[model samples]
Target chain A: MRIVVDLNRCQGYAQCVPLAPEVLKLNGEEALTYNPNPDDAQRLRVLRAAAACPVQAIIVDQLDLKK
Target chain B: MSSPTNGNALKDKGRIVIVGASLTGLRAAEALRKEGFSGHLTIIGDEPHEPYDRPPLSKQVLKGWVPADHTKLPRMLEVHAEWRLGVAATGLDRAKKVVRLADGDEVPFDRVLLATGVRARQWPNPAQAALEGVYTLRTSNDAARLQAALAAGPRRVLIIGAGFIGSEVASVCRELGLQVTVAERASAPLAGALGEVIGAIAAEMQRDAGVDLRIGVSITALEGDASGHVRRARLSDGSTLEVDVVLASLGSIRNIEWLEGAGLAAGFWGVGCDAGCRAFDIHGIVTDHIFVAGDIARSPHVLFEYQFLSMEHWDNAVLGAEVAAHNMVCEEIERRAHLLVPAFWSAQFGVNIKSVGVPSFGDEIVFTQGSRKERRFVAAYGRRGRIVGAVTCNNGKWLEYYGAQIARSGPFPPHPAGFDLPGDMRVVPAEFPARGVPTAAPDVVLTGHDPSERHAEFRPRAR
Candidate 1:
């Protein structure tokens, strides 16, 4: 799975931080700093982070080897 | 979990894409899961941050009592879905059943929810807006930076636009022991939302709070120092105010530009939707797959004769989200309507101000309980003989009763309510003059422009 974020629209609401700490983290200024790639073990947490976002800026996609 | 192989099973479940990661969007996702929606859920937002509370931005957060980052809203339950953060939905391809992202990616969906909220309207002058000392409060970072500036103890703060946010900012400045000057283009504060009679009381409150309340004046230009820091502000009345910091509480612009070619019923007033939260197209045709909620959702109110109404209140977002969510998954026979009465509250200048119903919708107002002179009162608003709205200052306990009256379409003047009237109980015209240009008393305005102009602007744009 791969995750993508648009920095311009993100207001740093941090809804993704609590849901997936490994993927989404808040910087010193409290801006939404995140990781686009995570281990498979944290897949569920990343999905939950995307769903919990108020501005819905988190996007997760499934990777296909055939494609 | 194994993927569904049955075609009939997959047909029953459909994907839902919600834009604008706002309070309404989050709540709707949660409500969808709770209501047994097992379809693919994808949420997209332009803001990188998660959904947070906005009301606190002007109050506790600005007052330095609470940090802006700490104002995050509490989630009631878990919502399982895909998240698309920090990316904007550039276009809505209805035919393709996909939302085009700014990054060129597309998310396929069977249903879409438009929850893109409003943004702070900035100063007209780009140079003035770029000044270090001039600020506008809307998002968390705005509040955070403003709070830090206020903590530094600026000598004086000049607040332009005496609306709710402006007034609240002034109140916070006073509490912080900093000199504050409030310049209002309107004659009295809150005249836009509450009318002249009630606005007069609010004007008195500000004057008593030691605010340099300047009414009927417009800011001509902002004078900045060598470092581009605001030093003073010049008004149209041939007067200048010396200040180190300035806060512009002009108003907000709805997030509708991205939906330009979406062919949806989206405009400056917001995206038009049916009572069931279904979005409408430019031709006034309702679309079942696309819904709207929060500040961006404009739907008709049964209590207000089905007049399409849009509210920016916090409560409206939660209620509208739940309704939108329920309607998204339920069958037509089981779908519900989003008809919740609007309510909002604000804390400023040591007074707890709360209002129930749409105060601006009323034509006449009456003092139903308490005394306005005492700085505590419950004023009832009526439209065409029916109670439509009510505002309370330090007397919010009576709002529930007034809200019920509004909901039931109760009568005007409400039969005295075991309280003494001003001898004449007749409800008179509220006399809410145009905002921006001052004429008489104070008023809380919902929009920056005059109410009449808003109506004119909300008309369907020519093709």
Candidate 2:
């Protein structure tokens, strides 16, 4: 599974970090660091983290799809 | 009208109606389609615009960094649903499974999701509230109007109430170099949400930022000029302030009045729902066809001693909508629980304020880390001996750590993080405002103590 977070839209609420700890992390207060791809075993956790984002900055498996 | 069927009878081929086309409604529609529900979907909204993000309206929009019209929420998936905008849901006929609309229309459905949310409370006096300079920030239009008014350069801006919205607007005024005064009835700003201890810190932040802070006072009356524009505000302490703009940031009101005769467990606190987001009847019996989400959903939390909680935060709305959508389409055994630990964030006075769990449920509080004098700290709230909530001001990097402790119902004064400890670790009263004081306590409400007291009168044959 692949995931991408729009850094500009991300406000570092850190809500996603707790939901997907291994894949996503907050470097400091505002800077967010995350893995772009992960094993399918963590799909549900990644999706939940994506949905819980207040700004909906996280996108899963939509990187290649055209708008 | 057809009778309501058992939960499993209608899975993906039935009609589904969703009331309120905001964040929760839009997310639910997207989730419903993702859950493989190929049914006819209808979304009804009173507002004309499509679903939009509301958080930025007070912060970036008011600051003129972002336009109000550009706050629309991004569409995650293509939801091919019938859209009904600029029309209000007048009533609900549970027996007939139909939603009455204001434009003399009726929409039938096998299942429905109510995400009506809340509206900003208006000034009490109609005439004074109708004045030219009076405004309340809730929708995109309100932000646009207020932004223009601020850009016009009002002589002095008087803001009533010191809630999150009010305080955020005050922050924007100061950033714009406008003269602003905040009048609050509580002992300190944010006393209703974070309690007096943390509220005191917030009060200092506002004052240090050049805000004319006035506590323990309320605006008794608003005097206006002959042109129907607000000029001066009279205070309870016999003082008047000359002002050109007035913002009544007096919190919000739940949008559940239209469901009065619907026989749902709805009242001043909001509509009641179970763990699966199923709406409860007047007799506390869960209904199969109706679900609740967003700010209008009041459900019990296992973490907070199973007390029914109503959370008006972005996280709760999104999480609750997904759960409600899943339950609406799946069988009972395949349903999921909406067990979201309440969380929220506010940016004001150059500080990033964030919190997890229900802060109002805690009786005692202690600053565990960071420096309070510098306005960058983390305070943990404890009830009995368990940590119930934590607030971080400009110290949100530790929010996830504290949130973990709250989810586990960890011990109070939770063993210090082994670093950045405060000089004094003494626990003190949280000092929440007394009941009956109209404050910003709506963000997280522990509705009633007795579960049985939440039920309404069941008049089965009233119609």
Candidate 3:
């Protein structure tokens, strides 16, 4: 699965960090870094992280594939 | 082993009814489908609109950056459930396992989820609240009305109670270059959520952003003009201000009235539930069919000394709903506990304030990193030599680090000092107001023991 984060909407809430620590990481105070592609085994964790974002900034490509 | 056909027959068949069609209800509906629950699902809500995002109602929606109607939450999955909008669940008949609606309809269910949530507390005076310009920012309708009022360019906006919602509105008014006066009864802003030490900094932030911050005073009365529009506000300090718009940001009241005679352990605090989100009877006996989540569920946390905590935040609603939904369909062996560490975030005065865990649970605080003078710092809350919570101002990237410490019950005055440590790390009292003191910011409530119960009952199951 591939991940995408809307940098413009990401206000650095960092809610997605702990949920998917292996997939997403925070660089500094407000800068966020994440892996665009993650193993399929991490689908559940990635989906949770995406859903937990307050701003709905995170997007997963798996949903698109299902479409 | 059972054949695949037999397993499929047992997969899903029962009917599930979910109360409260807001964030929690909507998410749980989708999650139930994701959990392979092919049962008949029914979602009931009082609001006419479908599930929509609420955090933006106070920020982006009020600012007109996004319209109120456009805040509808994106459906992550197709939830083929019956939608009963604009009608409220009047009562829950647990004996019959059905939910009574206001429209004289009864929906039977094998399982039920109560996520009624809370509503904003309006002005005490009904007559004043009916005035044209008096507003309370809770629903999308409230935000749309207040946004139009702000767009109309009122001469002055008189905001009562400097809570997070009130403070956010004050910030928006200043950004629009309108005169806004915030009158708070506490000495500092947000003293109810974060202690006075950080609240003092918030008071300065409001003042620095061109808000007429008034502390230690309350709006005694709101006066309306001949046209029945709010025209002036009388303060407790024997002063009056001419204002066109008045917002009563007086916290919220849990939507537990509908569950009054349901025999559930629900009251002024909220519905009492166990760690697994199963509702308890008035006698404190855990029930099997009924469940609760979101802001209305008050379950005890093991990390916080088993005190029932009621958290009203965006994250809590989403997390709690997922937990409730999971337990509603899965077997006992597959069930999980809802032990999510309480967290919340707010954006006001150009500063992003985020907290991990319940800061109100701590008795003392110590600054670990950054500078408070710069309005960028991280403070850790300690209780009995353990880290219970942490709040960061514009330094949310470090939240996960502190949140880990809080989850493990780390020692107070955290070590492994980062490179950006503050010069002085003096431990001081958090200085929270005495319990039962009414404040606008009622973020978290840790209720220990039942306050209303007079007697207890015990029963033993046959071996």
Best by lDDT: 2
Candidate 2: give the TM-score of chain A.
Answer: 0.88
Ranking by DockQ, best first? Answer: 3, 2, 1
| DockQ of the candidate models in sequence | 0.03, 0.07, 0.10
Put the candidates in lDDT order, highest first: 2, 3, 1
The residue-by-residue lDDT of candidate 2 on B247-272, one tens digit each, is: 99998889987898898887667899
lDDT of 2 by residue, A1-67 (tens): 5555654346688899999987777643555555555556878889899999998989775422332
How well is each residue in B1-463 modelled by candidate 1, as lDDT tens digits?
4322232232247788899887788878888877877888899988888776677678767877656775444455567789898999999988888999999999998778888899998987998889998999999899998999898999899999888999989988988898999998878887888887887787898889899999989899998999999998999999988898899998887898788767777877789999999998876888978899999889999998899999988778888989988877776787888888888766677766778888888889988877777767788899888888898876665677788888889888665667544444557788687534322222212334775653111333342
Candidates 2 and 3 compared: the better one by TM-score is 2
The DockQ-based CAPRI class assigned to model 2 is incorrect
Instruction: Supply the TM-score for candidate 2.
Output: 0.86
What fraction of the reference interface contacts is present in each model, in order?
0.00, 0.01, 0.09
Residue-level lDDT of model 3, residues B1-463, one tens digit each, is 5421232322467788999999899889888888898978999999999887787678767776657775666566888999999999999998888999999999998889999999999898999899999999989999999999999999999999988999989988987899999999988889989989999999999999999999999898999989999999999999999999999999999998788678778876889999999999877889987899999999999999999999897777787989988888776788889998988877788787888989999999999989899878999999999999998888877777888999999999877456699988999999887776444432323344776745443221221
**Comparison by DockQ, 2 against 3, better one:** 3
Give the TM-score of candidate 3 (chain A).
0.89
